[model samples]
Target: MQRYFIAPEQFGQHTVTITGEDAHHLLKVMRMKAGDEIMVCDGLGRSVLARLTSLEAKSAEADIIAEMETNGEPMWKVTVAQSLPKGDKLETVIQKCTEIGAAAFVPFQSERSIVQYDGKKEEKRQQRWAKIAKEAAEQAHRSIIPEVSQVMSWKQLLLRMAEFDLVLFCYEKEGAAEGSGIADVLAAFRNTHDSSREAAILLVVGPEGGFTVHEADEALAGGARLAGLGPRILRTETAAMVGLTCLMYESKEMGGA
Candidate 1:
């Protein structure tokens, strides 16, 4: 069934109203008419089976049949802190990672980052990424839309990592012989996971040029384990997706999916 993400407010008393661009898409693009059935998600993990009751130029209203439980959200919350890359890599990462169950995307400026976002540029990028995440959530049938935060500095990113139960940094500089690899990290979590303990995973990926030695050291010192994504070097965007996908699979295997 087709799904659309709506604001929590749009979910009124037994009715789901879609306005703005979504209304246009349903009325004009999708050519949906009255009595057509569709799924509506509140973008907060609440979904509903709804049928179109009225279609107007400014809005579309649907009568909600039932509230679907929040079953799609993964048991583990995975946040991706990716260093700003060049071109449209950020957009791609946001869309793909959302589909893969990333809870949030944090764009940070690293020491080796090539792209710099200051002031207005940062705000514009955040807006674009958020839009991509929302569309991706709808496409993937996700109940919650992963957020794309404003670009921050490496230090700021590190501070934010403190909020998560486990912070993992994908260090390209980490050799294969490194004591703790990505697999090892996953194993450790799986072996020690507790339902009573609210745990969250934070994956950090560097830019195309990768992180500077000092940056990697800082992350490690800040309590993030430096794990290798194998010996092969991955591009900035690719590494982020890799880390997130692995987290989802591992979380699922550990009953956190």
Candidate 2:
């Protein structure tokens, strides 16, 4: 079924009003008419079946049928804090990571990061990232859209890190070090999590040049686990996705019984 994301206000008691470009797509492009059935979601887990009842020049109204939670979301939130990479690497990161079920993203600038964020560029980039995330979520049939946060400074990144129950950093050096692999740390973290309470995981990945010694040390000091990906080094864009995949797998959120 084709799915459309509707705003909160558009989702009234038992109706959905899809407006603007979306309405145009349905009416003109898709040639949908009254009595056409479609799936609609608020991107907050409220997914429902709706039957189109009216089509206008700028909007389409539908009657809500059934509402249910989408199973595509992870059991817990997983936010990736990625150091800015050069070119359109960040866009690719947002796009793929969202498809893989990342709950949110934070693009930060570290000492060795190749990309610098100016105010104007940052605003435009955030919007672009947000759009990418939304499209990826819709394509993946995800009920919730991942948020792409503002470009953060080192201190700002740490402040957000404080909110997560556990944080993991993709540390290449740690791969060769004894007992510091991602699986090891994640296993321990899962064992210790309070089942009575909720938890969030923050996965951090360095840029193309990787995190400098001081930066890595700061993260370690801030209670972020420096878990190694593997023996081979991963690119800046690949590390976070790999880390997230490992984490979700270990946590039994990725198809484990």
Candidate 3:
């Protein structure tokens, strides 16, 4: 069945209202009629099997049948803080990371970032990134869409590090002796936090040129732990996805008993 995410307010005691683009997609694109069944999610981790009760040109309604058990969310909330890369790499990062179970995405400017931030096009770019995340989430069958934050400056990103319980700064220079292994860091974090509560983690990935020595020092000073993805160097767009996949596998979100 096709899945649609509706606002919590749109859901009543036993029915859900679909409007806007979603309604158009259902009525016109999907050609869904009354009594057709589909899956509905509140985008707040709640999902239900719903049957179409009414259909209109610009709106639709569905009756909730049964609640669904969705385990698509990861135990840890991993936020990808990626420095802007060239072209549409950021879009690829957001889309892939969302599918890999990233809780949110943060685009920031770094010292080595090839692509400069454009404030005039911020709103348009953010909207595009957000749409990518939503579509990826829907395709991945995620209960909630990952959030895409406004592009931040290096200073802003440093300050924002305080909000996370753990921040893994992906530095290319980080080697076996100097850098912390991802598995070890995550294991320690899991041991410290309560199993029942989701832990907030910030995975920082630099741009195409990667982070400068000064920037890495500043990140360490800002409470981020230097971590290496592996021996091989990864591109800016690939780093977030690899980091998130490691996290999900470590947390057994990928599959475990």
Candidate 4:
């Protein structure tokens, strides 16, 4: 069944109003008519099986059939703090990482970042990124949409390190002796923290040219643990997804019983 995310206010005790692009997609794109069954999510980790009650030119209504049980989300809330990469690579990262169960994304300008932040177009760019996340979430059958934050500076990102329980800094220059492998670091974190509680984790990936030695030093000083993905050096766009996949696997959200 096709899924559509609806705002909380639009969802009532036993009915949901679908408007905007979602309404258009259902009415025209999908050619869905009244009485058709579909899935509706509140984007707050609640979903329902709903049957269309009314269809209009610009809006649609559905009667809630039953609450759904969705387990697509990861137990840990992993946010990707990615340094802005050149071109549309950030978009690729947002789309793929969201599918891989990223809770949120924070794009920051690193010292080696080639793409300069454009304040004039920031809102437009954020909207685009958010749309990508929403679509990916719906496709992946996620209960909640991942958040895409406004671009931040390296200093600002470092300051926000205190917000998470663990910050995994993906540094290419980090030697095997200097940094713990992702699995080891995650194991340590899991052992220390309460497994039943949802932990906030930040996975930081640098830009194409990677982070400068000084920047890495500052992050380490700010309590971020240096973590290596593996022996191979991944591209900036690949690092976040790889790191997140490793996290999910280690956390038993992927392959474990």
Candidate 5:
């Protein structure tokens, strides 16, 4: 069965409505007709098995047969704070991390970051990143679509740190240091996880040359724990994916292995 992510408002009693691009895909591209079975998901973690019943020029309606279980959401929520890397690297980061169960992606400014954005470009880039996340989520069968936030300044990143239960700064300089290893931090989280409460984590990754010493100091002062990926260094795009992969693998609901 084919799958489509529909807006929450479109899901009504006994029937599901699909419009816009998705509808066009079904109507023309996929050529789906009445009686076709399709899996539909509301971005808010609700999925249903629906059968196509009617279609207009660019919209399709389906009858809700049964609601499907939403098991694609991770037990732990992770927000990846990525310093904007050069070229289309940010797209790769958002796509891969979304598939890895990252709840959101935040692009920020860093001392060593080479790429810069402003005005129209910034808005357009964010939109592109969002679209990438949506496609990735649909492909991964995720219940929730990860968000891609606007680029933030250093001050903004600091302010956002307080909102999360845990903040991990992917510091390459954190070598064999106490409380600075990713494994140590993850172990602590796994051991202390109380099912009753939700865990919101922020994973910060630096750009090409990585964070300057001053940035590292500021992050620490702002409540971020420096954590190393491993002995070998990873690129700006690769770091966040590693962080998300580890988080997903350790969480019970996200196919922990």
Candidate 6:
């Protein structure tokens, strides 16, 4: 069945209104009629099995039949703090990470980062990323679209790192040299989290040039664990995806049982 995400404001009583692009897609593209069955998400982990109540060219209403909690979300809230990479890599990173269950994304500027974010570029980039995340979330059957935060400086990044209960950095230089691999770090984190308790994990990935020794040291000192993704070096976007995959598998798949 096709699924659509609606804001909390769109939901009320026993029905929900899907407007804007969603209405057009359902009416024009999907050709769904008033009696057609569809799934609607509240973008807050609630999925409702809804039956179309009315349909028009630009708007549609659906009567929610049954409401259920989304169980696909990972037990741990994984946030990815990625340094802005060059070109369109950031979009790919955001889309794939959202599909893989990243709860939020923070694009930060680091010393070696090639793409500098001034006011104008940052706003444009965030808007673009938000659209990408929304589409990806729908495609991946996710209930909520991960938020793309405003651009932050390296100093601001450190300050936000304090919020997470656990943070892991895929420092290719350090983790590859040392014996601590990503899998090991994930295992350790998984052991610490109890299924009955709420926990959050933050993973930081640097851009093409990767995090410098000085930046890595600062992160390590600020409580982010340095871990390796494996022997082969991965691109900035690839590193984030791999780290998130490992984390989701461990924390959600295995930890749940």
Cα displacement (angstroms), candidate 6, residue 88, comes to 1.1
Ranking by lDDT: 4, 3, 6, 2, 5, 1
Model 1 regions lying over 4 Å from their true place: 195-198, 253-257
Worst 10 residues of 3 by lDDT: 172-181
lDDT: worst 10-residue window of model 4: 171-180
> Model 2, poorest ten-residue lDDT window?
248-257
Model 5, which residues run further than 4 Å from truth?
176-179, 253-257
| Clash count per candidate | 0, 0, 0, 0, 0, 0
* 1 versus 3: better TM-score goes to: 1
Residues 165-210, model 4: lDDT tens digits: 9999998765365437888788899889888889899999999998
TM-score of 5: 0.93
In order, candidate lDDTs are 0.86, 0.86, 0.89, 0.92, 0.86, 0.87
Model 3 scores a TM of 0.93
Candidate No. with top lDDT: 4
- How do the residues 104-183 of candidate 1 rate in per-residue lDDT, one tens digit apiece? 88889998888877786766777788889999998888899998887889989988877888899998766486566788
Name the regions of candidate 6 deviating beyond 4 angstroms: 252-257
The TM-score that candidate 2 achieves is 0.94
> Total backbone clashes of model 1?
0
Give me the candidate number with maximum TM-score: 4
Provide the global lDDT of candidate 6 against the true structure: 0.87
For residue 58, model 1's alpha carbon misses the true position, in angstroms, by: 2.5
Residue 199, model 5: Cα distance from true site in angstroms: 0.7
Clash pairs, model 4 backbone:
none
Model 6 Cα lDDT, one tens digit per residue, 1-257: 89898898889789989998899999999988989999898777888999999988777888889987687677789999999999899899999999898899999999999887789676777789988988889898998889999988999999888899888988887556656898787778767767677678889999899989999899999999999988898989999999999888777554556
TM-score, per-candidate, Cα-based: 0.95, 0.94, 0.93, 0.96, 0.93, 0.94
Report residue 172 deviation for candidate 5 (angstroms): 0.3
lDDT of 5 by residue, 1-257 (tens): 67788889999999999998888888888888999999998887889999999876678999999989887787689999999899889899999998888999889988888887677687777778878988899898888888888889988999999999889999998855777679888888778778667799999999999999999999899988889988778988888898888777666654425
